[model samples]
Target: MSRGKTASALDLPRPDTLDAGKQQGAYEALRGAILNRQLPAGSRLPSTRSLAERWLVSRGTLEAAFDRLHSEGYVQRVAGSGTRVCAVIPEQFIAAPLAREIPRRPVAPDQPDAGVQSHVPFVARRPDASLFDLKTWARCISRGLLTVGPGVLEAAHPAGLPELRAQIADYLRSYRGMQCEADEVIVTTGIRHALDLIARSVLKPGDTACVEDPGYLPARRLFALAGAHIHAIPVTADGLDTAQLPEAARLAYVTPAHQAPLGMTLSVSRRLALLDWAARADAWVVEDDYDSEYNYNTAPLAALKSLDSGDRVIYCGSFNKNLFPGLRVGFMVVPNVLRRSMLRTLQLTGHSVGASDQLGLVEFLRSGAFVRHLRASRQAYQARRDALLECLGGHCTVSGQQAGLHFVLWLPPGVEEGDFCSRAAAVGLTLQPLGKFCHALALPPAVIIGYTALTLAQIRFHGRALAQLL
Candidate 1:
């Protein structure tokens, strides 16, 4: 019998079985393994030496098989990292996999209680509402009530409560290095509302708007709602790639302080180039200055709005990051030239925020309580982040350590991101996949590990669990 026929007896495909050649037979077997998810996304293959031995084939045959898979986009050969299965499997192969469903990992009895609606597993961007100072918050509400007058109760400027605006302006100046005055500040429910206002004021139907590729999804969805053409630009190690920005976009939205998911601060050089692009193109830049206050490593870079020379930047910030999201309060600082028109748009739409909530936040800002809360929260989150890093050592690579509530954890080759997350969720720990954040780009398989809301004990426990799963 031929040597190839001898290999066939071992369940390896014989070289003579197909018209394409020996390489084709090997490819089919490997492809079947991939399609069956026996080798899941981000999983590394055995070395050619090992695979050749297992299949009773030569090393050259295995190499040829790998080359074909790489060419077809079923796998990737990252520099320094070995070959890994693509997170987005090729469409043709995907149909076969859909024939069978991936079974859900059964939840164990010892699992922690996932909220009725929320399956968050120590997720990112979530602040701990339990830590809130109830006494101080109540006192602020009482102060607003006692001091409430007819003027405050009746129709007032759509720009927001004058006191709250002034407080925000002062806070921005001291903390973010933005040199705006009270007239520049406009109160909104949160960043989404702020972006909606910007879209209404600046963007028109068919106007192009640029956003980061693997970015905040809600922002991208908001741009789509405004009838604008959305462009997904790639985010680099530093931050958003300003060079990839279209020269004719009407507006661009970015998170510079702590980039949305990647967490890298926009470099000074990129910031300059972005502002230059905005100025020369006559475009508006929305600086979503979210979560800059919780930086743990270096003092944060000065905000992007601080570098704007042409008054082209619209600065948006929120108390939600430092406090809680349910507060539904945020503020935007528009350029003086655009402030009047933006306010008019807001007024016409009747987007006036609640008077009591504004007054309560105003008190929170004035009484030094906000800064105190920030200081304490920063320390607590830092501890959680440190605990995660400690447990994560040697298991996977973690990035975006400088700021924000969460960081990206890139699993090593041979580990499957989806499978890892499923096992985690089965144990009552819900982890978010990084692929969900991408629009027009494919990122290395990863998960965003948020540490802000989790305590050290929780971090250590979950982190250990995650490490074991890896």
Candidate 2:
């Protein structure tokens, strides 16, 4: 306290008087000011003499501080610009180090029907459109249009059409091993919308959650935006490694049924172990049963929700794999207790599934069209998965091939995921590096290729191309 006068912040003494501490403190203060946009990108710093005078520091000390900033690329010495801030920083600028930064959860965005074809020559994700029975689908849509009396195209019932819910419930029971009532099914636009709703409703700012590293980036972004602290767990060949689980997280989001980018089922033992962990940790598990319909071999593992003794699992699935991605129809099976709140959320968000589309889906399911579609897509996707594996030969081993639309090619030790992806794209085929999915760890290098949209022929073509490229 300076007598009766309020102490001015700028006039405060240099508390970090030690040489090393003072230099580090100066760097941090200036960096914060620049990052917060207080100092615009091109702004110049005060002269050494001026800064020394203002901060009551020796000229040599001020010069040393400036030199540190310059070496760190935070400031530049231009011919006439007088040491202005760098116009662009490096990619690693301000990026938190793996051990120092809080882990971020990765979440995929809600995909719009319009953008499904945005990246043309798109060879990502599951779907054999050429093999799809478009005539059958057209017939169904036409029948629905003819059957509608009036206002069928109007706004929908907020809770969704009862018929569609019943259909989805039956399908889940028969295929997904879900023991849920129709009333508990809430059809969402996709997983993105469902995740956002769940985060907004169930999680509060600063609540901790766990996500798979080298997992879905969209989930990570969503959880981070909601202000939750994310714990990044690694996904292995048999889904996420629960042994490395972080204890403090209150919730976890996973794609256990079929790990994304690297298609692998959660082993039965790991499934139970993960559920047990959740029970012990008192955390909620959001099981994204992604690409469940596109399994390669015979009977896959049962849904994680199938083993939920506690009302802790929130299950989500989409027809993006089984049917066309443009369908944009995914269902979230909530626990009975959360059903009403979930429905109310859908209503409040005005994201009620379309009545006509839902009715059409009802017709499709009851007529067994959906199952037929699933079976057909399964056979086609399984073929592509095989082709890609066959193409890999002995270059690099593939991971997560028992089920799901895509798999990862764990590259040679020297090859970084980013460099491989960039170099491959330079040669014409777009590939996603596995490292992009990592949140807070030094991710292993691997290329994740999706075989869903590509045909067996395209897979072979790219396989040879990739062989040469790799």
Off by over 4 Å in 1: 1-119
TM-score per candidate: 0.73, 0.71
Candidate 2's displacement at residue 243, Å, is 3.6
Residue-level lDDT of model 2, residues 293-411, one tens digit each, is 76677776678888998878999887665677677888888877777777777778787666666767877887888888777777777777777778778767777777776677778
Give me the overall lDDT of model 2.
Answer: 0.74
**C-alpha lDDT of all candidate models, in order:** 0.82, 0.74
Off by over 4 Å in 2: 1-123, 145-156, 246-248
State the TM-score for model 1.
0.73
- Separately for all candidates shown, the number of backbone clashes (residues 3 or more apart, or on different chains) is 0, 12
State the displacement of the C-alpha of residue 224, model 1, in Å, after optimal TM-score superposition. Answer: 1.0
Best by TM-score: 1
Instruction: Score candidate 2 by TM-score against the native.
Output: 0.71
